[model samples]
Target: MHDQNFTSLPDLHGVPVFYPHGTQLIWISSNGEITRPSRETLAAEFALGVVLLCHRRWSAARAAIDIDHYLDVMELFAFVRPARFVLPTPSGLAQQLGLARPQQGEDMAALLPQIAFILLDELASTPDPARTEAGRIATMMTAGGWKWGPYILAHLGLPQPLAGPPDSRYAAIWDRLADYTDYTPQAEPGTQPILPDAARQRLAEMLGENAELRLPQADYAAAVAASFDRPDAGPNPAMVLAEAGTGTGKTLGYLAPATLWAEKNGETVWISTYTRTLQHQIANELTRLYPEAEAHESKVVIRKGRENYLCLLNLEEALAQMPGRPRQAAALGLMVRWAGATRDGDLTGASFPAWLMDLFGRSQTNGPCRPARRMYSCSLPAL
Candidate 1:
């Protein structure tokens, strides 16, 4: 299959074909004619057991392609689906795997050999642990025999059957972090006082070799450091209104002192962002302070509203309706896989692809359950 050259639509009748742009499905006929099939014809062909392959399933579905039969190569490999901004086309996958991308305007049919080789290579190279997990999830969703199961088994080899239904007990683990009783408050001032030079030095250290000491950034850090001075404030609170133009390193400037103060005082410092994008940016910037992945997970946290995370109850409800909803079941199955591997329960800005919600017709992260709401009501201390 990897060495075969495809010249016509009949050659790819039952074979997986790569289509990068998802807005429309194109076919190259035997006479070298490009044709776009109607959604009805596409559905009929799928109903008659025609198999199509694509990078992202959601894109094909949007183009009226049947979601039940088509194989999503990206989801098959990634396990955790990638964001939409990252294209999962043959070229995109090749680039990610450090292989050469298909040339521009290259024949789509001729690219079949390369695509087959890429998929086979990726499957062969996948770690056993990941393949096992992916197979288990796929088996659970397909129930050992469904439309996509045979294809997966024939092409990629069958994975182990699921041990049983996934344990829902693991779902509430996020709620356990809200135990404020375990938190101990800091009563006295920290032993090490935060000064402008010290904060600037910390910032420099955090930036490493990329550190470009800006005078304004140091001054900003100095101003923010003064906020910790109880003696200076006396009976009132100290407020610093800083105004800086774009491109000034204000985030690192303030973070230096804030992190230092938190560490020395053994306190939690809450840094709020107006937008989710900025929140993610701040989280990314913390990598400089905590370079190790596990240490960063333990140190810095991104807390959002209850609506941003998944509700286990809602997921159970969605799963219960899986009878006539193959698409919904597939989406939920993917989410279940993601839940197991997610760093936090956050479904919005994390690795959980936004397109999955679109597949199921609604966002899973909205409308928290009562228990989830109550859990979010309590104060969560930083780890």
Candidate 2:
């Protein structure tokens, strides 16, 4: 209904308009519950026209257009619409055909002429009333899929110029829209030891092993005994920055205290290291001794920032819009694949390089230092 009679009508957002042969007036209505004729909707309707033409293998079409063309044709409708168009072929089909080569300078503008010609050819070839209507309907779907242009046209009240070759100014507009391709058929805070007894014990051992410390048998016994006697035998928020001087059983000293405190205080005991070597040393030591703690340690995640959490929402949006580096794109893709099942935001499938390690910290919560850290009484005893 729209393609044949409404092609030349102005975009009035989503409103609809009708013209009668030799008639002085056209009927117009806003697209609400009633759905009036507008350029916004018409643009979408036209996009569907592109898709239909593309589908039927009609890749060339032409409509007589002039400076007045923009104003006059849309006058038939109720609103102005986006003047945007793609040239070589519709993005939907181009991707489908697997001929979606990277776009270049003139690709977008060049495709518009081809699409215009294609539409003209399709209209010329169609004979059946139902088939012709069906073709038009399909075009609507394809065009509607592209919501950006219609939105800009409707909201911004921009005129779709119908004059000669689009100027450099308009080329910038096209360039901005170079990659609106629809692709792929795919889908906070708080500390405290919430882990179960078994999980807690596992966590304790994991931390102990991570520090790779072996306090003297006497020290380990004393720390564990001290933890057992404390009002609560779990970790407290204590800052422990251990520097090994010569042969200080640094591993033993760190492990005994971390394990005992975490187990006793019932809180996560964060161990920040200045070097990757230290981080690994603690991890290896802890794992070697308390293998059972490995799983819990894995759960003891190193959260960085909100951006690291796979941000499935932002990822899909970015992909659709086309932004960021190739690495970013790849990271988002990996995130899309793994994020659904990951609660802690840890991606065990791939190793995050040291350079990328800092990216995870982007998600860290900002605030005054933790209260536990500020108060000595609350700080877990390091002895």
Candidate 3:
């Protein structure tokens, strides 16, 4: 139904999102009333949910959008499903895709198929719903997946762009984020590396002076490799420090050696960075070089200051945790969306605004469910 008629996001933020449970479009309220939302509300929410799941797939498909075409197609991304809800494909992927500039022929009507297709697979997997108001909608697209443009044209007349509810909190957190949570299929973890020398040599070879463009900087890399290969020593592992100007391959120099050592030792390598962007940068590099290890978020993982990752457990309790607090309802709604949609759970998942961050801190009534540092081990911890 949405692909048929709605052009913009349904006007449904804070209207209460719901899912198809068996047949009925029922919402269990705070008082436990089984209620049904209005037609517009249900349509908007189902649309939002579908997009939330498709964010990463959608981003991967269009990651490298050319800047010239960015504005022309900007409206397509605004407050819609998925893109607005989830973190985007990282900048590295986007730039690599080399998104093409919008050609002179492109327009909204021309882009409908692209927009609707984002939710195609998601809708197909959606549980069956009774042919109630929402169910009738399922009838059309469910029969055939990804008919967004035709469905919208035949059913929905025009999609009008919508703004999220007036509540500043939803916009504060969700607005800055783009959906990119899709694309990780659970892959087998690689075998623990048995060859320390092999790992180091591999790193050196990749970045060695003989390599293309002369990467590896043999001098810096040799020093890093030596520490890991140190013979039989004390409990305190050797640490070596070396510095060089830009273009010196410092990041890779350490990464190649560290990766190999960590794999061989079955130890966790902590790569600390001040910025989330750099954190993601290192993670991306690891993914490229050691995809299997990075996939498991083991062999290599990202550890930050902890406050940055959204706490799924604490976020769910925002309302019950502090009833009657100003903006509690809106904050809860926003947090719920972020919690469900985010993959990495980082505060930057949505470029989280400071004001929204305050809502997650020690509220007057409730404290954090657990220490933030323990978040990675158990994000959904009990209070």
Candidate 4:
């Protein structure tokens, strides 16, 4: 039955049959005849077509077929309930893969089959064979002996299932933050101070050879460097407030001396910004000093209010109510995928797509569920 290379789609269509208890499988013929086939028959016919399509499209490095026009053939095959978890919708899958949204007036539903197959490919191709969400689902499918499982296992070679819940280093990070202690002031070590000229020179070096030196920016840098000379016995701390218009290099000006002071004194420096956008800009600027992603992550931290991040407990609670709430569930499932992939877990500023946030609405992203909270906060070692 699977031997025929399907150049064009047959009349067969599979539609998800959702019940109060769970989802069921039903087939629709081209003549508009609706029928419920036995599991064995479903496997031999409908399931075989879906598998063949998957093989025909994704078996190689790239798909041989467009698979866009065959959404109806792959529709019923997309719905899978493995033990407890509900897979995200195709739109959520697209978001997780960092794919761009469909254009205005385009039908996103038409691309579901393609999105679903891409997601399956990702699940089957996870590196190092870890106990990821992919592995967990694969294990569940193998254990349950789902009709379509073998085709996926044989063609894509799903990662071997490891025992226990999926590994969540992301969740563990937030848990460790619960024991966060108050910052204790430390004595600044006596080191040769960096004067204004030296600070200006450092700024120039950071800006690179092509950068034009601005007189005002250099003056600002020198003033900031001079502030580091405050005596330990001073009753009040030295503060400098310089008013400058946009594009005057205020960020690099201040950062030049601040970084020098911190490096010389072996101290932590905190640079506060009024907006998240500026915070991200400052973080990007820090990259010139620390080019490597891992190095940058180690040296710079972006701090924000607790409400700005995703709470793991809240996500768990949301996932539990996925039975009827398909939209929210899809968003939550995408968040679950994102949780594993995000670097800092900043829901607003991190890699999580802004459009995906609009999917489930703001409630889920607002860091609700106050009872037991664990939030992803960005942090760096030195500054």
Instruction: TM-score each candidate.
Output: 0.70, 0.29, 0.46, 0.58
Ranking, lDDT, top scorer first: 1, 4, 3, 2
TM accuracy, model 3: 0.46
What is the Cα root-mean-square deviation between model 3 and the actual structure? 16.0
- Model 1, 167-202: lDDT tens digits are 332222233343333234668655455777778888
Kindly provide the TM-score of model 2 when superposed on the true structure, using C-alpha atoms. Answer: 0.29
Q: What is candidate 4's CA lDDT for residue 237?
A: 68
lDDT of 2 by residue, 1-383 (tens): 11223355434333332221121212233342222234444354434322112211111112111111111121111011111112323353234234454263234223322333333343345466423332322232223232122222222233333222212121111121122222223222222322223333433454454554434432433333332233344467322233555565456445555555555555455666676556556666665445776564553434332333333333334444322222233223222222322333332212322223222332221122222212111222211
Candidate 4 lDDT (Cα, 0 to 1): 0.50
Candidate with the larger TM-score of 2 and 3: 3
Q: Model 4: what TM-score?
A: 0.58
Q: Name the runs in model 3 displaced over 4 angstroms.
A: 1-125, 128-200, 204-216, 229-237, 292-298, 321-331, 350-383
RMSD of every prediction: 7.1, 21.4, 16.0, 11.8
RMSD value for candidate 1:
7.1
Query: What lDDT score goes with residue 117 in model 3?
Result: 38
Instruction: Go through the candidates in order and give each one's C-alpha lDDT.
Output: 0.57, 0.32, 0.39, 0.50
Best by lDDT: 1
Question: Backbone clashes per model, in order?
Answer: 0, 58, 19, 1
3 against 4, candidate with superior lDDT: 4
Q: On residues 27-120, what C-alpha lDDT tens digit does candidate 3 reach at each position?
A: 4332333455655554444444332112222322232211111111111122112214322222211232333323322221223233333333
| Number of residue pairs clashing in candidate 4, backbone atoms closer than 3 angstroms, sequence gap of 3 or more or interchain | 1
Estimate candidate 3's alpha-carbon lDDT, on a 0 to 1 scale: 0.39
Model 2, CA-based lDDT: 0.32
